[model samples]
Target: MRPREHASQIPPTRSASIETVLVVTMDHLPGYEIREVLGQVVSSQARTRNVYREGVKSLRGGAYDPAAPENLTRWRTDAVARLGEEARRLGANAVLGMRFEHREVGEMWMEVCAYGTAVVAYRSPAAPAPDQPLVAAETAHPAEPIDSGAIAEAPSAPNLRTAGETPTRPD
Candidate 1:
């Protein structure tokens, strides 16, 4: 199979081309979750009066403080963008099994990782063609290795849902 190419070569199709696989380290951060943890720490330090205030300030000032949710959000966003760019370069229209890894370095440095498999995807083919087309059929088959030019002709699948149809729930 040929290596992936940047999105420029293949014009973006109307079909999603995007795949379903995605992964995240932290699923959701409800306000209550953050509040509860902070509340407990605050209450515990209340016994020492102003000590908690200093602790909070110090935490905020720390180079790798967890209090900075915005930094984490930005990191995540950039990582995803990088991953997407990599996928695009590989001629993959979608990424699957996406995941992130976080590592703390010493007292100040932290590293965040985002990774996934890049894939060239098209909507599922309808009825099979009687004879193989000019491009190799294996190129369109997910299990088979990819073929650059062969992928260009793969037909996109039709959307099953109508305008009024409700989306089906996952089992």
Candidate 2:
């Protein structure tokens, strides 16, 4: 049997491609379980407006166009596309906790960065079964829940400050 080819080489069908490389701002995705915790993936691009486009805009009395750099839709699309490419390189199917940021490099140039944690996610297989507490048929009250020590212990540390003294690290 032959192994499957890379997903990028073969374009995904519409419905399948919609979820192929998800980029979500949320830390967790609904109905999808993260199977692996891949490391960070980042992509960035810097761009300046085309001289011809700027000339056209100036000729039009500086009127706003949907594609202007200030509007940034094009730059964002390019950056996110690059980000998805990086995630795919990592063998990740989705990117979680994704974020976008921009910085001005000069009077005319700006840079945009897209970053997130790459992860492999699978659709949740089954609806969770609601757990029912075992109880006596004749009991009028619910049984007390046992303490499972789920709460984490606080780390041991010295006091933040001593009385009549500024808070400082010990010598």
Candidate 3:
């Protein structure tokens, strides 16, 4: 039987269409305020592996290549893109705490899943102009100074003894 050609290799030049939605692994985006939480979003992709090719390659004493088409990185990227698209469809501008998961189905199939919390966020307004210096309120109660004499002394360290030995008075 003729070996099947490797398919589903993501072209290096093609964009994943992830530009519309912002994705972050953190729960909150710095400098941006979340206006609304739109709930969780997820995407999944499953691919079949050519076990014959892999078995033949292993028999030939060839080590698996990390960059080969069999690697799940490409699928993971696609999953993230789909996740972003889902977020966009839900009217969310961003996905926070983005995460990826991988699973194997029996022996020939594998799946990649991506998930995150969708949210609508906007850039936070700039800090108030430097002209208005922040000041403490005059009516606020002041903290009282600590008095050294009023504090109780720290307890002395306990004497440690060996497993079966009794404490002996000093000679």
Task: Output the number of the lDDT-best candidate.
Answer: 3
Better candidate by TM-score, 1 or 3:
3
Query: lDDT of each structure?
Result: 0.45, 0.68, 0.69
Segments in model 1 whose C-alpha atoms lie over 4 Å from true places: 1-56, 59-67, 126-171
* Model 1 per-residue lDDT tens digits across residues 71-100: 677676666666655555454545555676
Q: How far is candidate 3 from the true structure (C-alpha RMSD, Å)?
A: 16.0
> TM-score of each candidate?
0.39, 0.57, 0.61
Task: Compose the digit string of candidate 2's lDDT tens values, residues 1-171.
Answer: 011223432233233323357778999977777778789999988877577877888899998875765458767777777877777777777789999999988767779999999887777766543474433321333354433654322234334566447565889
lDDT of each residue in 30-147, candidate 3, tens digit only: 7777877889999988878778767877897987755556467678778888987888788777789999998988788888899999877766777545476532221122254444
**Candidate 1 vs candidate 2, lDDT winner:** 2
Question: Which stretches of model 2 miss by more than 4 angstroms?
Answer: 1-19, 51-66, 69-71, 128-171
Name the top TM-score candidate.
3
The order of the candidates by lDDT, greatest first, is 3, 2, 1
